[model samples]
Target: MNDVLFRTGGHAARITLNRPRALNSLTHDMVLRIDAKLTEWEHDPAVGTVVITGEGERGLCAGGDIRAIHDDARDGDGRASAAFWRDEYRLNARIAHYPKPYVAVMDGIVMGGGVGVSAHGSVRVVTERSAIAMPETGIGFVPDVGGTHLLARAPGELGTRLALTGARIGAADAILCGLADHYVPSAALGDFVADLAERPVREALARHVRQAPPGVLAGRREWIDSCFAADTVEDIVQRLLDHGGPEAREAAETLLTRSPTAVKVTLAAVRRARGLGALERVLDQEYRVSCACLGSPDLVEGIRAQVVDKDRAPRWSPATLGEVADADVERFFTPLGDRELGLAGDGPLTAPGTAGPGAGR
Candidate 1:
């Protein structure tokens, strides 16, 4: 019920996400419903365009309902969890290639699955209060929902830095990082969206946009690149510690406290995604790794400590990034064997994180 809202106005089809209580966090049912609606609109002649937005003022979508995945795994339902992710990934791909003008009114907190749903659109609008991030590593997961594709395109090691640290970026920083296309004031979203409902083309919407200040991350390029360039998280940590500044030292301590295996594997996944020719391939590789992490102790422990238990401290399987080995990392990427992420139609494989076997453990 609190999933999707569909309405037709003028020549446009509007899809409003309705789960504001949880920041419109996506569930498996929501994912399938969105896919169905998009498919319906794609073939409908009266619908000349589509708009995707969320309810409430707090945010767009936070991400997927990981609580369900956690529950499924606890019940020996890893395959079921993987199936949901596969469908979700397919929906993400559909948004990316939709033929019409797909406009995303990204307001408050947009992240993870939210990024995938809206970032691939023909038009992406951000606002002053917009807080965007891909913080999967912090939760013992890799950035999925085609997030790796966008992260791969980010300037320098900025993607890796964001992925590993779960750092929140403002509208300015988001625009600078290529995550947002246009910036309109947060106060103007309601009026702009209303106006947009009447105007169906790209150019008409551009007139409503007020020029925004350049992104905040523009000046921090040198520092971010230099700090994140290190190959290993430990190396980056050392660099941060050596910098003798509050920012660098604070970042280093933050990384040290995160799941060590998560940081290490996330770095490798980010680097690998950069080399892939397409998003599908990267997602495929991610699926294999994610399946391997099904039995991983860290996935459950991390979720319990952070989401279920609300405890700040997580007891990681490998307590430090330095403790994760190349073999331990390689296991995640190993082929799914017979347990492939197959779907009914044209769908993309999606892994929970960019990790190898034992990642969950």
Candidate 2:
């Protein structure tokens, strides 16, 4: 079977990830297939909505196939890697702006690229087994896949914390943090998909659910707001060091272990993209940052230590947090000219403030 499957049933177009072994890790081809299907369905009169799910119980998607990315980077032809990101980012923009209802079964692992596909959907269902995270920091990359946009909208420094630490949150936390909408048991996904296949009854199914998922960081808002209120990464770290609790302290430690240059540039990028730019524009900015990641010192070294060598210690450029220069960090936002990803001036897929549930929150 194809790694990614696209079909039409009833009023909804069904897209399924067929990879179970790798937890449905999305490769570049899978992304292309998904985009092609979405394009085809856009104009198809028979299809009314779209539902995305995975083949196995392990995850909707673990993330992109980073191993392939690492190898492409190793070969010095970062062009292919860049193309993958460009197309993937475009797909994310399409989904975010898609006109019809987009439903996602966010059971099991949903992280990194998976968030781009599922989080922005009109109906995002999480289960007890849901494990959501933006773990790009662990691999020496900023959280792309439109995660920066979501992070930008998160309350206060909570966005910064998730972007930097690569921490995982359960179903309850995913809802509280605005990453997911509804909560349902994983076992119910089959019936849910079956229902979607028969007709457009999402409103009715939503009302039939039992107790909702718990909130992951409910009471920590005050602390998250206070600690992340700093102007810069260093300032935030200092704030955490001064008065944060165990959660804040541990998050601080995670940041310290990441590439200093990457952490700084990522934080700055997230903050800048918050209000001034829309989702696609911010994704374009992320494209520039990702392209530069190949030429930069942090990405390769990070992959070597974390993925290849398995040493768990990356020697970041400038070596320490204090050495990252403001100018150096600014280069990430610089335009790539012809290499840039462009979008038309027409309206987005969804209305400005109506993308999915709790959009722009």
Per-residue CA lDDT of model 2 for 232-329, tens digit only, reads: 88988888887748878887888889888888888887888786468877888888889888777678778788768999888777788899889988
Worst lDDT 10-window in candidate 2:
352-361
Model 1: lDDT of residue 41 = 81
Candidate 2 deviant stretches above 4 angstroms: 344-361
- Local distance difference test, per candidate? 0.76, 0.81
In model 1, the runs with Cα more than 4 Å from the true position are 342-361
Residue 108 shift from truth in candidate 2, angstroms: 0.9
Q: Write down the TM-score for model 1.
A: 0.91
Cα lDDT, model 1, residue 247: 73
Clashes of each: 11, 4
